[model samples]
Target: MRKFYSTALVGAMASAVLLTAGCGQGLLAGDTGSDEKKNEPIMLGMLIPQSGSEAAIGPYMSNAAQLAVDEINAKGGVLGRTLELKTADDACDPQSAAAGANKLVTAGIHLSIGGYCSGATLPTLPIFAKADIPMIIPAANSQDLVDQKLKNVFLINGTGAQQAGAAAAWMAKDGATKVALMHDNTSYSKDIALRTQALVDEPGGPETAILEAVTPKESDYSANITKVLAKKPDYVYWTGYFQEGGLIARQLRQAGYTGKIMVGDGSVSPKLIEIAGPEAAAGLYATMTQTPDTLKGAENWIADYKKKFGTDPGPYSNQAYDAVRLAAEAVTKAGGTDGEKLISALEAIDGFPMFSGPLKFTPEHTLSTGGFQILVVKDGAFALQDALQ
Candidate 1:
């Protein structure tokens, strides 16, 4: 759900070239481009999962986008014109996300924000790039997206590569000499699992005892369980979502294998506790981007957000908020809604303060490597872990 106003749209947007038209006596008044640019609204799109397996995340994403919109509007709107948003559900699936991206291009957005699941977000990149729309990815962080090298795409989240490195480092710190790397064969999960496997493996790589893949969304993982238990590895790193991850944790405990368990970024949902039960979920490590609650100087904002939204902002909500604010600020700084100008503005950002952290984008348009945080399920919630220990 989004709101738009034609009358207030882009009224204040004026290019430096256009503003000086009247100052030059030789220039014709008709050549001033303000008339052409001011009539269009500063339209932005949200390409997030409103419906799908990840539908649970829609509200949090929407709330963050709306919060940014509200704050920008209160500050006299971006570029002195009202900012508007149009949302299209990406559904966290490739085909669906592509359709949503097309819908946004058809609506003629000035820019776009939001991309959650990497599987869904990947296929939509071409659509945004082809339309010349700058995309600000608040959450999706697949290495594939980075490899694509599209100029219009920017990601505030750490890449899968960074996440994998974090996991491998934690394993080393934990003294997990014989670790088992497992994945559920999903794009997001498998990518991290494979990369982590490579990092932890010897140059020649490890045997089957250290690597495995499982079918996703299955209620029973006993078949895989039997195979894993046979190895007796000291730690199991599951690069997958919480639904299956929780079950694996429970089964590991049931099978009486007591080493340690850690999950990938996608498995950070609180529902993991429900899936595995509180007891089994306890002590399970999760490699994830820091959420608002865990970030320094976010306590009051988190409290205010909970009061306003009726729930703690979900995974990536803080980043989503920062993405929106960044887009708005960049558009204002450029003094117009031009996509190219916005791209330049985004790249110029250096440690811009956000609730999540002081955000800065690299040359590749992704966040820095140290964005990840190690979390453990302590007393049914994800709390920061002292990884050194």
Candidate 2:
């Protein structure tokens, strides 16, 4: 699924660097002291769920990565060497993620451009940190990822904290006096749930009716819905993935407990509509980054993706694509794939073009603007409801 190559340009550049820098201190020749073989392709690694309940998203992210790689290679490659993408299956499980991270490190990837489930992504952080590989995370936005304070980690997606704020704000604007928060207990889900609870408990915010947790992958959630309906909340928010979220949505609607139903980004998949049934899923709301269908002026890109993959681009595809381009840019700006240099180059990025907006990271290494918008499930698809301006 990957290709590598060395060109005369790369060999010449390496010879030039070695001649001028002199092999003294930590400064080396064209190899950039990164110890990579001269003229070898710059290796990029990705860890996505090739097999798991979330496997539906694997193609969206991986195919986008390949698209970026092909585009970059066609344009003279990165740093005179073509980029090669190697992937490992994280399976959206912590143990699997850890093993996959190690596999990527051992394979000698210069950078990582993947992370979908925060629960799975969390365990891989220390693994990558220990190996000194900089990560340009595409999806997984758990604040816990930032709390670790690992310099090698950089999140391109909005953080969980930002999503929580957006969710709570939307609830207020909808005139909800009481809200129920539900989570699947995954790291990503729980982070948003806890943060939203805190924000809604603040002065002038709505009353939090209940903070509920549900076991994921369960077939039934009627008991949980019963507990929630007992609270008589005017609004309900589910901060979890689509599988459980869809069932919960359908159950809530069946139980006649719907004031309004909204979900976090993880629940923005079309499968949500299928699982909940179109009627039940109708009018469903989500706090999400712009998807291919909702992004303006992206018709051509989306068409190309469809032509390539034989289907429409899904959620997180643009983010994954951006991650690849950002990785290539960092490598170019750094002059090599040295992890430390790449980190510095990424920190220095300012106003780079991205589908969400101009790209810039805060001091905390999160997007300056979360780029979350309100999306509603209408006629079995997600469309922009509010840009939150």
Candidate 3:
């Protein structure tokens, strides 16, 4: 169900310039000489999962990026040039992501945002690197992404290490003496799970008894549930998307294992309750990247997003918004859009207010000190359990 606004509506809402090489020669025939130069548009590509299992989160991120561009253009765009976002659907698949990356490069896009899935983003990294196009990943948090050290890639979301550290600290504070770690075997899932295990297993930290890996597409997890139950862990932390996390939570409860269950940001979606049923999802805890609705300084952004999209914003919407805004700010600071210049600008960002917090990049181009908020399922909805500062 793709919803497209009227051409007039799109133009009014966003000063979009749908310019291709030879799409409208008649419209530009009369506007010769100097006027043509003034109307030229700067293109920023967006590679998102518009069709796939992860598609639910993609459109929100893309919309957030568009919102930032619209706001930027409304108040005198970069170098007096209007910024236009050209979107390509990667479907959260590696092959598709590579194709999308190539398409954007061919379309002459210098900067881009998106790729929510790490598996998809990883394959496309070389494509962006070869083209010298800078990509600001809004939601991919796999540690391997940074470990690869691609010169043109930047991550707006905190890494798996950050999430795992916050989660381990919270669990330890909650008196979880023995914890079980479960992952879906994907790069993002396994990385966070392993990190959390290491944190909990450290000397003087809480003891971790079990580390289990499960296929994400498996429907039945009774065997795994039985194994986890046998361990008698005080808590179970699952690192995976909503699909598997919901199923594991459901089966774990069904198998009479009632430990304190927690999940990473992937399981924070409302759909988890629907998949696992409200009773099964009850008391489940999750750590998520800050959201517009949860953060104090996001009221204006939430209002504007609702006004523009006619819906509530998703969990990562603010992160995507910040990603685009930070990219634009970086481009401005660099006085140009070259890859090296933009990378330096991104690293040099300091004390900028974002939906997350006062933004400052570490030497590695990661968030300096912000942490994830812990949420628990209460009355069939995710409620804030503890605010992380």
- For lDDT, the strongest prediction is 2
lDDT of 3 by residue, 194-296 (tens): 9998899999868989999887788998988888889899899998999888898899988888779999988888899888899999999998877766665
The candidate 1 region of ten consecutive residues with least summed lDDT is: 1-10
lDDT of each: 0.77, 0.85, 0.78
* lDDT value for model 3: 0.78
* Alpha-carbon runs more than 4 Å astray in model 1: 1-41, 92-99, 201-209, 215-232, 269-271, 274-277, 306-312, 386-389
Runs in model 3 with CA error above 4 Å?
1-41, 52-56, 184-187, 214-231, 241-244, 247-259, 274-277
> Mind giving the per-residue lDDT tens digits that candidate 2 earns over 6-123?
2322443344344434542234343564466657999999999999899999999999898888877876677568999999999999999999999999999999999999899999
lDDT of 1: 0.77
How do all models score by TM-score? 0.77, 0.77, 0.79
Ranking the candidates on lDDT from highest down gives 2, 3, 1
Q: Which has the better lDDT: candidate 2, or candidate 3?
A: 2
What is the Cα-based TM-score of model 1? 0.77
RMSD of each: 7.0, 6.8, 8.7
Candidate 1 per-residue lDDT, tens place, 97-207, comes to 999999889998878898998889999888988887889998888788899999999998878887887888888777786788889887878888888877888443332
